[model samples]
Target: LATGDMGIANTTPAACLVAAFTGRPPEEVTGRGTGIDDATFERKVRVVREGLSLHRPDPSDPLGVLAAVGGLEHAALAGVILAGAAERVPVVLDGVNADAAALVAVALAPAARGYVVAGHRSVEPGAGAALSHLGLRPLLDLGMRLGEGTGALLAVPTVRAAAAVLRDMATFEEAGIER
Candidate 1:
């Protein structure tokens, strides 16, 4: 399974989710979405702080937190992650939105953390926080912040190539080569 998100201004709620889960400060998790200017970036950070302050979401109760601060897309992506975990499938998570949702999924099912693979690291600070909390290192980091699964898509080939190398590569003895 692979996860991606496409929505405007979704990073605001993502930062909120990261703060709620990781206990990070709003400004620490927040970032400029779509290249906003100074004032807009400042306001975005403020909005994230206000939302977290108002909601006071409990990370232990992921459902309650989602209800309080999650966007519809966040909830939807969380569902995908949960479903993938249920089936013991590895999920490739993309960007900040997917990272936030992955946090929600792990909170709901701690074992689910093992099933998530970070496709790539986003420039978004929240993405780093979420990946760190999940103990996941992204497979790629091309300074990507574009959602819509572009990063994940780019990572799929890498995953496949790695798998192929593990499965098909021959050892020195198998290749009849001297040690």
Candidate 2:
């Protein structure tokens, strides 16, 4: 399942959700999103930390965590992941926002984790931490910080290549060549 959208302050919510779910320091999960200045960056971090504290996410209750700290895009992405899992389709997570949504999805339905693919490493600080926590290695890392599915869109060719190799490339036996 592929999805994309735009929203302001998405990174803040993402960082907060990630820190809440992973128990990481908000500073560790936060970054200079969209060229935010030092002061603004600090404020973003503080907001995330405070939001986490205010929400007090219960790891066992995914909905509570989402409602308390999640952005609208994150909630939608979580639904997309859930739908993909129900249909046995893979979801390619884009940036920090999508990764945050995937985290919520996995929390709500542990089995959905099997249906998710980390498309790329986003420049967002929480992106790397979230992917690491989920044991996912993205196919690319171009230092992209955009959150509009740009990274995931760029990864489609590679995904297609992998599928081609798996489905069409000749095996040694079929080629009748020496190993």
Candidate 3:
């Protein structure tokens, strides 16, 4: 519901949660998305703080956490992650929002973390903490914050390359190398 609440706005609950999880006020962690005026930024920060304080969902219970403050998009992304994990497919996480959803997925199924791939690093401070918690080192840092799965889309080539490597690379014995 948080994303719905901030429709067309850059201020997302994932962004706010990032700040909260990192123990920083929004002023410290919030990026100037689209260059809001100072007054608007302050208000945005206040809104984030209020949202977090109001819910205060425990990280251990992802369902409760989602119902407490997350939006439909977050939940949907989490379902996607879970489905990928179930199918044993690699799932690329895009940005802070994806990271937040992945956090929920991990809480739901600890093994899901093994199937996740961080597509890129987000400028959002909360993203780093979530990445660290998930033990995922992002594969890229293009300085892009487009969210909307753009990062994951860009990571496709890397994923295909990894698969090709595993499938086509010859073993030292097969190549007749004397190690």
Candidate 4:
């Protein structure tokens, strides 16, 4: 399973969600999406802060927080992540939107964190914040911000290689190697 998104200004809600979950200030989590101008960036940060202030979503209640601040794409992505976790499938996360949804999914099921894989380091600050909160180290850091699962797709090969190694590599004991 992999999560990605194609939404306009989706990072605004993601920034709000990250702030609500991590208790970080909005400015710290907000980023300029699609290379917005300086003024637009400032407004984006303000919007995130206002949304957080208005909602005051509780981190412990993931559903409530998501409902209050999450966008439709975020909700859908979170559901995908939850389903993947329940099925014991690895869910590769793309950028900020996917990362925010993963936070919601993990909050609902703490064990779900194990199923999540950070595909890349998004240029969005919220993506980094959410990854840190989930204790996930991204497999790639290409400074990528394009969603649509581009980053996750790029990381799939690496993930598959790692799985192959784990499945086929012989242990030192099996190889009879001394120390």
* Model 4, CA-based lDDT: 0.92
The per-prediction CA RMSD against the true structure, in angstroms, equals 1.8, 1.5, 3.8, 1.0
Per-model TM against the reference:
0.92, 0.93, 0.85, 0.96
Q: For residues 151-174, what per-residue lDDT tens digits would candidate 2 score against the true structure?
A: 788787887798889999998899
53-150: candidate 3 lDDT, tens digit per residue: 88776666678877776777778878888998999988888777778788888888999988899988877665677788788998888887666677
Ranking by TM-score: 4, 2, 1, 3
Candidate 1: where is the Cα deviation over 4 Å?
169-179
Which candidate leads in TM-score?
4
By the lDDT metric, which is better: model 3 or model 4? 4
Q: Please identify which of the two predictions, 1 or 4, would achieve the higher TM-score against the true structure.
A: 4
Candidate scoring better on TM-score of 1 and 3: 1
Report model 1's TM-score to 2 decimal places.
0.92
What is the per-residue lDDT of model 1 for residues 1-179, given as tens digits with 9 covering 90 to 100?
77888878999999999999999999899988799999999999999999988889999899999889889999999999989889988789999999999999999999888888999999999999999989999999999779779989988888789879999999999999997
The candidate 1 region of ten consecutive residues with least summed lDDT is: 154-163
lDDT (Cα, 0-100) at 89 in candidate 2: 86
Clashes of each: 0, 0, 2, 0
- lDDT score, candidate 4, position 7: 73
| lDDT of model 4, residue 102 | 92
Q: What's model 2's overall lDDT?
A: 0.86
- Which has the greatest lDDT? 4
